[model samples]
Target: MPHMFTISPDFPPNSLAGWYIFNTWFQKNTGLNIHLNLYNSFEEQTIAIDNNKNDIVYVNPVDAVRLVRDKGFLPIARVKNRLDEVVIAVSEENPISMMCGLKPDLKLAMTANPDVNMISMMLLEAVDLNNSNVVKTTYDSYIIVVKNILKGEADAGLFLAKAYDDLSNVVKKQLKILLRSDVEELYHSLLIGPELADRQDEIQTLLVSMTDNPVGKGVLEALDFEGWLKIENEEMEFMIDLIDTLVPDTD
Candidate 1:
């Protein structure tokens, strides 16, 4: 049976088609028949990984920690242009200058994902605000979170710095970042499940060497990444620790 490779849908569906092209080239070069599965939500993806239904997965730093610690998945490689920091943004017209400026009954907007929610909570805590005061309005994507704030449906929103940079200039003019989270240099990782342990080295080599091939280079371009880099366990320790500190007793 072919191995299953799944991706978290942190990005748009159109962008994810690059994985199909990469998978084709990967199968040809490595002689490994890997099927591609794209998940629309973090919850679905995590469930699949936990059920041992996926042989390989592309996950963010938070999910990477959970899979590694609880599911026995090994992180092999990471996207070169991974997210590093998140921004707390509000309308330029709003007078909120810092997180402390938020009213006791805060109407916050953020992506409906565990990692982002945790980061938002941590940022709130940093300013000595009770997270319980936050009335969260979840959006499927960062762009929507920004839109919700622009539409006056949300008082503030949290989104990745990169996503904020990618916003249109007109939209940029309307929003101002009140606070920038401390930089946590982290990457979206490619993890190998226990079922694929025997082929870990081979798979890692293929991914790390992808940029060298013409087809792989094209796929990388489509995926908006420079290349993949081999990752060390120690590189993710900070993220794990941050999560633990923010959310106590998280397994």
Candidate 2:
């Protein structure tokens, strides 16, 4: 039997293919029989972690914080292009120059994930938008959220700046960023569960040094990241505090 690692299904199909390629290379280099496990939702992924079914996992910032605080997961490395903040965008033709200019009947589109939803709520609060008047719609992906805005199904959308940058030029021209938040306190993280405690140092070394090889470089390119950076427990304290403040109670 091989060790199983879990990842969130938030990535697009093409991106998932790249991950499979990377996983194959990782197994070849590390001489470990590890399997890639993909879950369809955040809830399912977290449940696997809580049940001690996962060895290593890739997850968003909020889940990383939760797992660290509650499930004894250790943060190892993070994507080099980790997001600093999220953006609120409106269609260019909407005539809304500022977030506050948004009308009460605004149809807000956002991904259903906890981190994004929390940020979306914070952004709405910043503009003093009444919750009652805002029509919130949840989607599976940032691209869908942005598309809804372009198709006139949403008045505005919340997405990471990186996702917006990845949009097509024509799509980019049709949207205007109303505002961007200050540096986010959290980042997407690679985590090691208790099952991999003995192999922590070795795994961390391999991941951080992955880009030294051609196979690793190709994996990084496919994932749209420069490289991984090792993270310390102390470095994640701010993110933990921020998550605690934003969510209050995860249970």
Candidate 3:
């Protein structure tokens, strides 16, 4: 069977084509049978991981903990200059002028995406809001989260920064961005499972050098990445530890 490669569903939907192109590029270069398996939601992908051996996977910070610490996956590379940031927003007409002004019994829309949820909770700490104070409505995607907020179903919504930026101008104008997290160190990474340990050096080398060629550069552009950066072991551990500290045990 071909080695399966998949990306986190939290990635921009528009990048689907680029991933396909990347799969083709990877196969051509290494002469390996690399299949690009896709999942529409994070739950679907999680279920898949539990069911099968995914040789190469690209996932966000939260999922990385499971893949690395639990599943024997090694973090190889991450996209350069692409950090996972959260944007908390509300309907433009809402009277809540500041983050701290948001009070209890508020309706909050968000996805079950762990890192975003964790960061959102931490951000709300500025206002002394806890999960108990706000009633959170989980959505399948950021689009739905924004939709709920705009329709008054939610007082505010938490979104992945990239997802929020991808929204059309028409949609963005009706929503007010309350605040965005500036966590500059966290990002999604391309990881290789234990089964592919032999190819670690090869995969990492190709990824980091993609910027040298036009075809690879185009693929990077399609994914909205400037380039790839090698993730050192110590730095990777630091990122995981930081996440543990930022989010409490109760969260």
- Model 1, position 168: C-alpha lDDT score: 80
Instruction: Give per-residue lDDT, candidate 1, residue 235.
Output: 67
Error of 3 at 30 (Å): 2.2
Candidate 1 segments exceeding 4 Å error:
12-14, 236-242, 249-251
Per-model TM values vs. the true structure: 0.87, 0.88, 0.96
> Alpha-carbon error at 240 in model 2, in Å?
1.3
- Please give the lDDT score at residue 59 for candidate 2: 80
What is the full ranking by lDDT, best candidate first? 3, 2, 1
Query: What lDDT tens digits, residue by residue, belong to model 3 across residues 1-251?
Result: 99999998877788889888888988998888998998888888898887765878998888887788778888799988889999999999998878987988889999878888889888897888988898998888888988898889999999889889998899999998889989897888899889888888888899999999999999888888899999887877897788777767784
Q: Name the regions of candidate 2 deviating beyond 4 angstroms.
A: 43-53, 130-133, 248-251
User: Model 2 TM-score?
Assistant: 0.88
